[model samples]
Target: MASPARPEQNRVVGIALRLCAATCFSFMAASIKLGYRHGVSTPELGFYRFAFGLPPLILWIAWSRNWTAWRTARPLAHVRRAVIGLSTMLMGFSALAYLPLAESTTIGFAAPLFAVALSALVLKEPVGIHRWSAVAIGFAGVLIVMRPAGSQLPALGLALATGAAFGVGIVTITIRQIGRTEGTQTTVLWFTCLSVLALGTLLPVYGRAHDATTWAILFALGTAGGLGQLFLTSSLRYAPVSVVVPFDYFQLLWAVLLGWLIFADHAPATTWAGAAVIIASGLYTLYREHKLGRDRPKADAPL
Candidate 1:
């Protein structure tokens, strides 16, 4: 058995891994936006992202000699996860094309809120007042950021981003349900493989020729995405959900920085304020879940 202090050390390491995952995900978003700027279509980008990402995951499985992870009794569950997850990726990358990175990222933060409601409606999970209250507060933050009446972001962009968040919430619930029987590698493997096959089929219709820089950007997107998944999986293995989840909010900061530096995009005061509210609500919700002894492993970054 491990020493009592061992868990504490794991928590520390998990926090670090979560932070790294956050950065990798932010970089993935930036790379997606960069790829779009170079004339890559969303479908093509999605195909490359998943296809290129597979090698790392495959190598890891081989290193661990966990070839059994490839075998699954839950093929339908994986197919369901893959379909929804691929839709989430397409919508999210599309949103990045139309919205500033910070704004799109802030909006994506609402996934946890959506997950809370879905838990009750779909999973028949009982949610207490505290979690419900947090959900409400988080949506309020979303409204503040959206300011639908006077918002400058294109309506389609907002719709896609919100849709992506909704898709993520569904993915989260599916993950929790299937997590009972699937190893982390199995889940990740199936999702990536299915996404690649699904998206790759559409490439001929949507794909465009890429220059050297664009090819590099696509490769970077895949690398960052694959590494991000790995880091997030490792983090959860090392620590409890409550301990490392809050670190995910750090992606907003990374998004802001990357947006400003790469795109010269600066979010207004309202966006920042709304992000703060969302972050606070999410942290509080996680805290409440922990207190209620209902904490569960959460999906990692949106990427």
Candidate 2:
């Protein structure tokens, strides 16, 4: 019999998987932008993301021999999550079409801020002064990044990005409720399968022939998304959320680099400054939640 891995080794493995997941997701976002540039419609991209993503997840289920993950007692809960999750995906992909990747990515950092408020209001979770203060400062950071007055960013993009974040906030709360009775694999598997089914209905309207390059981009987008989901799921298996969640922020850095390299995009000083503030606020919120022994809400990687 093999000895069990030590805690330190497990943590190191978790962090590595977390970082890899971040990279895959970052690359996935870049692919979304690239696919848009290649004349792939937002809805088409959305459909492909879930359709292609489902295969790898199914493979993972088979490999793990976790057939129970496919059997959920909460059908209505899965439907509800799928509805919200699919809408969030379309809004996020549309936002990428309107905003630079880096800016879109920065706006995404606000999801946790929205989650805090949603938890307090919807979940009626206890919110002390510290978490509330963190939420306030985090919104301030979002404002800084938006620079609403004399802002060059597109209004549609800002609205879509912000809406997506808000949707994520609601999803976070919903996940907490479902998570009490459901395993992560069940939640993820049902959401992905349902999303693929729901989005497939739109194909007759938005689907079109694309060049080989565009097809390749779509394929890569779904594959990376599936792989990222796997890595993220596995990371939690190896280490606690507190150990790996912080590395999720590394996706922003990857976004910046990819945006610059591929799109000749340069994020402004305000964007960087705001990202720092938002990240700090988020980190502090996590710290306070852990300190208070509250269940820290998890932010799923963006589609």
* TM-score for each model: 0.95, 0.94
lDDT of 1 by residue, 23-123 (tens): 99999999999998999998988988887788888876776667687789989989988878888889999999999999899999999899999999999
Give the C-alpha lDDT of model 2.
0.85
Per-residue CA lDDT of model 2 for 169-225, tens digit only, reads 878888888888987768898888788787788889988988888899999999999
| lDDT of model number 1 | 0.87
User: What's the lDDT for all of these models?
Assistant: 0.87, 0.85
Q: Which residue window of length 10 is worst by lDDT in model 2?
A: 1-10
